[model samples]
Target: MMLTSAAQAIGLFIATNIDDIIVLSLFFARGAGRPGTTSRILAGQYLGFAGILAAAVLVSLGAGAFLPEAAIPYFGLIPLVLGLWAAWQAWRDDDDDDDDAKVAGKAVAVWTVAAVTFANGGDNIGVYVPVFLNVGPAATAAYCVVFLVLVAALVVAARFVATRPGIDEVLERWEHILFPVVLIGLGLVILYSGGAFGL
Candidate 1:
């Protein structure tokens, strides 16, 4: 059962972080010309993800003391709202070249990347909270271990993909549209699976 739970946690971590590949790829591409930037990006990603994990664990443990399970799932709204907001921003900036300037003008700071990562992981928190709540302490610890290791793997994969030729062009062209749509879809999945809609 412990192994099974750990496997399930690994699967969940991958599912929630699939989009990180794209986001991290973009960050890497932006920093491709800079030295030592990859390390910063990696650090930022880890910090952001750790923050999300910590938040989920704290909330799940705290709320479990008093909140009903049904009420807990409503946390899915966080990602849903963030998704809608991202979609709106994409629409507003559909014709703008500001994204290029934003990427080029500044060195991507660790904290900036961290903030983006955390903000983008609203869905992760929503999904993780319930999973953590349902598991035993040992299982939870196993999940955390699995998540940390996989997250490192995720960063390496994103970096490789980002550095590849031709991929950056495609990502740059479609990112604005793709990112928000994925977020919205992820949000819906979380809401539905969490029974937030009572459906």
Candidate 2:
């Protein structure tokens, strides 16, 4: 049972965080050539992930006790709305200049990254709640620890990838379009998995 729980946790963590690599890579690329920026991005990622985990635990506990299983999935709507908003912003900023992009890049802060991470992870809660409910406290603790380690490793890998010479050019060229498209796709997947569209 312990092994099974651990495996499940690892799988869940990977599944939920795969997209984080892309997001983190973008952040790392933006922070490149700036001293102390990578550290700030890493810190923000950790902070954001912590928020997501905490929310999952709280919602899992609360919803397990009070909310119906069917209704719990509707939380996916949070990400859906956020994604739509992001897409709209991206569209509206289609004519943005390099100067604006530079300004936006300069404005990247730890808290800002944390907020983006947390908002981007809205779909995680929909998947985590049920998983958390099925596991024991000990297993949950193990899962959290493993998730933390994996998230750190992910940040490192993303940073490395982002710093690669050719990678930055590709990311920079399409990031505006790619980011919003990814968000929108993620939202739709969450809505479908959560059965939100059924109603």
Candidate 3:
């Protein structure tokens, strides 16, 4: 039962945010050749994700404890709005261009990427909160561990792929094809799970 519940939570998480993970991996892939920097940034991101998930799970569990039953539905709406907003933003800005250039130095851009990572991950918290509420404490830790493992794997894979001679060129060329699809797909999943359309 514990394994089943953890699997369910993991499924929901991946269904809702796998695209973001992919894009984040790709973004970090730009720094791939530099193992030290890439690893540091990836570590920071994983830490941030773990922290947020822990806080969100605690908050949700607490809210479920104290809040009136009627208010729970409203909590679900947070992800709805976030998902729609993410979709809209993706629709609006299909371009992958960024204002910030990659720093040539080895300094960890923890704050900058962390800010973006947090914002990018905000909607996911709302989605995961509901799923987390259904799991036990032990399952929660298991879920967190599995998620961290998947993320670490993605980072390593992206770094490895980026080192290939022509892969970056291919990825860069296909950003237009990839970004919108991922954003829209993730957004729709979150939107549906959040019951944004009232279905």
Per-candidate clashes come to 0, 0, 0
Q: Write the per-residue lDDT of candidate 1 for residues 1-199, one digit (tens) a residue.
A: 8789878987898888887887677666556566787889889889988987877787777854454456545655654675687679667765775655545522557875676567667567768887887886778888999898888899999988976779866665665665556656755765677677785
Best by lDDT: 1
TM-score of each: 0.66, 0.69, 0.56
What TM-score does candidate 1 reach?
0.66
> Taking the tens digit of each residue's C-alpha lDDT, what string does model 3 give over 73-101?
33434333433554565456546545333
Which candidate order results from sorting by lDDT in descending order? 1, 2, 3
- Return the TM-score for candidate 2, rounded to 2 decimals: 0.69
Candidate 2, 1-199: lDDT as tens digits: 7787678778988898888888778666555556787789889989988987887787766744444556545555544565576568767776775654643443347875676677667677667777777875677788888888888888888888886889987776666666556656655665676687594
Displacement of residue 7 (Cα, Å) in model 3 is 3.2
RMSD (CA, Å), each prediction: 5.1, 4.1, 7.1
